[model samples]
Target: MRTYWDLCVGFARTGVTGYGGGPSTIPLIEYEAVKKYKWMTEEEFGESLALANTLPGPIATKMAAYVGYKIKGPLGAFVAIMAHIVPSLIGMLGLLGVLYTFKSSAVVKGMINGVAPVVGVMLAVMAYQFFQKGRQGLGSKWMIGMSLFSLCVIEFLNLHPGFVIILFLTSAFVWSTYKESGKTLFTRKQVMRSREEEL
Candidate 1:
């Protein structure tokens, strides 16, 4: 009911307002999911975004479907996908002729150029937020090290982004497990020392 409507409206806004494509729409989607409806926290959205990037196909569509499904299940997913793409589909159909007619017009070119910086700023802001969150959780040193390593691997070595994500995700999982085990062992040792003292 209300959940479904929210899904439709949120995704619709993203689909219609996003000018540049999948990447550009991410900030809009993040706002809707994190700030507007509170479907997920910023950290959850960041993780989901990373997971979505590792998959094939359109990122916005995938995000829309996932959020919808998370909120209201399969039916919500269908509604969300339709809501996200149908407006863009209709707009493209309606504007195809106009775009073709003004294909060489300077105004159209300028409009596109102007939008590029806005989209870039949106991406940069989201990235900075994610970096700040990471620093808080992992500390600045570990966060900086991982960021530099990832940048070098992807930019200099030309490694695939999906592989890098998988690598880091695995490392994080292993690190967490190791930390948990260490805590458990430390607790057990303390318990044993207490019993020995009592004896």
Candidate 2:
């Protein structure tokens, strides 16, 4: 059984230092869960990430809850979720205090302006990591296609993210079932191959 301290430390570290946004924080969470703790294999982490993306709420919190629940059920989930959120909660409060006191500080203006470059870097890294992880799980060429398709739909069509995710999740289920049943619903050549195998 994993101890509370172990869970707290691992997730707290992620929460405390995961600057920028949830996408940027994911790599940090992956490092602790998949690398430092051995809580999940890389493949499992990838799968978990996919599943978490489908769920409602912030991806980081959902991920922490899933990992913790896997390790120790409901109680583990509670601890992990709290650990993941506590740092952000404290940081927000601190920032609010700073903003209140430094409403007119030039230092604050400089800090905000400087953060854009760093955030851009973080987001770039996050996007690249997502590409690599998706490619590993879903082939290099196909990953690019899917990424482009998702980007276009999200940006051009302006569809809600939840709707898009649900659409893909349903598509994946149907595709997987077809593959498992040896049914070639989408290709005439594969249908013929399955028939030939039967003979």
Candidate 3:
């Protein structure tokens, strides 16, 4: 119960201060979910992030659902998801009302302009964090290759990010299975060779 409340508060803070956009908020979310709370490990969070990015809907909400499910099953998921969404919903409604009222206000325009660069900086920081994490997880060769592949697909080929994610996941699953099977076969061959030597 207490854990659930902490998660709610953590997500609420994420919702409140994630000014730039949801993608920009990802580093902060990872920090809270993986580092601060210890709810999940870095690898687990990375896997969840990849899975979330592949699926539709908001990244933040997907995070809330994943974290919620981790902690308290279905009910925890509900609480975390609601906590994350309610603030944004209220803020959007309030902002819409203000925008209508102050449509002609130069001050509002200046304020938005002022925040735009800050948002860009926030997004850059998040990108850097993710890059650092990827480097750590994937090591040098594969990291560079994967990053280059991603750049080519997204920039040159204009492939969807979701498609890329699916490819990555499928490749990882197949490689893991292959490696495991290879190890088992090698072990069996070694045993058979020892028996032949004995004969």
Candidate 4:
């Protein structure tokens, strides 16, 4: 029950407060999932974010569902998603007409413009943290090389991000497998050499 309530409140806070939609809400969601609730470590959350990006649909919803299900199963996922979206739904129902009418007002425009910078800073901070983590895990050279490669494919070649993530994941899996097999073969050769020396 406490878990359910926590899930509700956590996602609800993000729903009510998150401005500029899915991408912008990420930092707030990270706070609840990682810092507030301690549901996942930062590294786990980073991996989850990578996986979530590879899927379709709204990033916020996917993350809410994932965290919810991870903590409390399918019902928790239902609760989390509801809490995450209901506030936005109600606001949309109530404020859509008003916002549309005042969309061109200078005050409204300025308010949005101001918020945009805050959101940009939030995303930049998150990206830098992830960059640091990647550097620690992959080493600076590999991280920078992969970053450049990913940038080229994503920004210049116009390849989809989901495809790029999948490509990297596949490459990592293959490389890991090769390394394990090489170690196994090396151990076998060492064993054979010892046996020959004994003979």
Candidate 5:
């Protein structure tokens, strides 16, 4: 019960503070679940993120459910998901009322304009963090090349991200399989020789 309450509170706070909707909430959710709570390892969190990205529903809610399930099973999942959603539900309702009332207010317009730049900066920071973390083994050259290639493919070619992901994964799978087969065929002789020597 205590665990459920704590999880609920944690996710509720995440929902309340998370700005700019689901995509924007990702970093905050990662921070709370992976860094603050130690509910999941970084690798586990990454896997959950990838899975959530592939699914249709709200990313933050999916993440919250996964982490909660990891901690306390189905009941925890219920608590965490409800916690994460409730704040957004309430806030959106209130925001809708305000927006309806102040639809033409200059102050609201100014506030929106002010927030846009801040949101841009936040997204930029998040992008930089993702790039730094993702480019660890590849080095800057490969990282930059991949980034440029992706941008060209997505922006210029107007390729769907799902297709790009499929193409990359298919290529990687073929290459990995080929490499493994070659290694297997060549390494058996060496292994046999080592075994004979041991005998």
Candidate 6:
């Protein structure tokens, strides 16, 4: 149970050093959430990361808000959001004053080029971890099938992804509820097997 001030301080550090925008900043958020603060486990971070990507808006800010609300309340959310933006706001102001002075520097260009691969690797690692988390959940076989189906729908069928997201979410909720209630729907084939042996 951290205070609003704690949330502000913690999120502020990430906001200040979070270079390369939303996708790249994710790994930094993961470090703060899972490593430094232990606010969430690695698996929880992976799942939350996936959820954040699904929603609209900036990924880093979304994650920050989620974390703040989880630990505190709406006031903490406000504080966290403010802290996350302040650094970028201040940085931009400072940079604007000296923009022309450093814009053409070769060293600055080199630093940007160098950070690209690191950010890519971090995103790759996060993706892999999330993949593993998804593969381990209930209806995982259907999950695998849907992954391919989603790609086909997007690439070949040209369906909007929001529709697919809604479809899968609804189905998963229904499936999970049925499974949890011990009520089988598509278990006609298994009805006979249960009398003789468990499947």
Show where candidate 5 strays beyond 4 Å. Answer: 195-199
lDDT of 3 at 37: 90
Model 1: per-residue lDDT, tens digit, 1-199? 9888898899999999988889889999999999999999988898888889878899999999888888888999999999999999999999999999998999999998998999999999988998998899889999999999999999999999888988987888999999999999999999999999999
Q: Which stretches of candidate 6 lie over 4 Å from their true place?
A: 100-104, 138-145, 148-164, 177-199
lDDT for each residue of candidate 6 in 83-193, tens digit (9 for 90 to 100): 888988998998886776887899878988998888789989977766677787746786678788998998899998777877887887898898866655447646877
Q: lDDT scores for all predictions?
A: 0.92, 0.85, 0.85, 0.94, 0.82, 0.80
Give the winner by lDDT: 1 or 6. 1
Query: What's each prediction's TM-score?
Result: 0.88, 0.79, 0.85, 0.92, 0.83, 0.74
Best by lDDT: 4
Task: Candidate 6: count the clashes.
Answer: 0
lDDT of 4: 0.94
RMSD of each: 2.0, 4.4, 2.3, 1.6, 2.6, 5.3
Which candidate number maximizes TM-score? 4
Q: Local error of candidate 3 at 154, Å?
A: 0.9
Residues 1-199, model 5: lDDT tens digits: 7788779789998899777777777777878888888888776777677667666677888998888899999989989999999988898987998898997999988887887776677668767876775688568887788778888999999998767766765776898999999999889988999999999
| Tens-digit per-residue lDDT, 83-133, candidate 2 | 999987988898898788998899987877887677678778767877898
Model 6 CA lDDT for position 10: 81
Evaluate residue 187 in candidate 1 and report its C-alpha lDDT on the 0 to 100 scale. 100
Residues 1-199 of candidate 3 have per-residue lDDT tens digits of: 7898888898887887777677867776877898889899877887788779988998988998989899899998888888877898899888998888997899988988897887787778766767888888778788889989999999999999888888998999999999999999999999999999999
- Would you give me the overall lDDT of model 6? 0.80
Order the candidate numbers by lDDT, best to worst: 4, 1, 3, 2, 5, 6
Residue range 48-90, candidate 4, lDDT tens digits: 9988998889999999999999999999999999999998899
